[model samples]
Target: MSVLYALAGLLIIAAVVSLVLSLLGVIVVGALRILPVVFVVLAAVFFLSGGRIDVHLPDKWRRK
Candidate 1:
């Protein structure tokens, strides 16, 4: 009887941890998927401003 109670307690704890980790994983994956879209929108905005805005790359990043 005591062993069964212990096992149940452990199962509950494991389930809670798994649920939290799954939620975090979902949030991180969503952010990563949306990042490119965010950048594209910003770039479009800059271009629509009629060359008033410019994006500069670092010296090492500049194409030869």
Candidate 2:
């Protein structure tokens, strides 16, 4: 749980930084380059967690 949150946070930070850099023309990371990073991160999460993940939904969204 904490690990997933941390990983997600890091990915979001990296994406924001990447976007900022691209806008500044410091680095040109097009969509093609970004896709691999997303896939790799997803693969890492799935593999490292042994493909088991539990998601909890709020009561408001749950089926009665």
For candidate 2, the TM-score is 0.40
Off by over 4 Å in 1: 44-64
| Candidate achieving the largest TM-score | 1
When summed lDDT is taken over every stretch of 10 residues in candidate 2, the lowest stretch is: 24-33
Clashing pairs in 2: none
TM-score, one value per model: 0.60, 0.40
The number of clashing residue pairs in model 2 is 0
Highest lDDT model number = 1
Clashes of 1: 0
lDDT (10s digit) by residue, model 2, range 1-64: 9999999999999999999877867444565668889899999999898897689989899787
lDDT value, residue 25 of candidate 2: 71
Q: What are the lDDT scores of the predictions, listed in order?
A: 0.94, 0.86
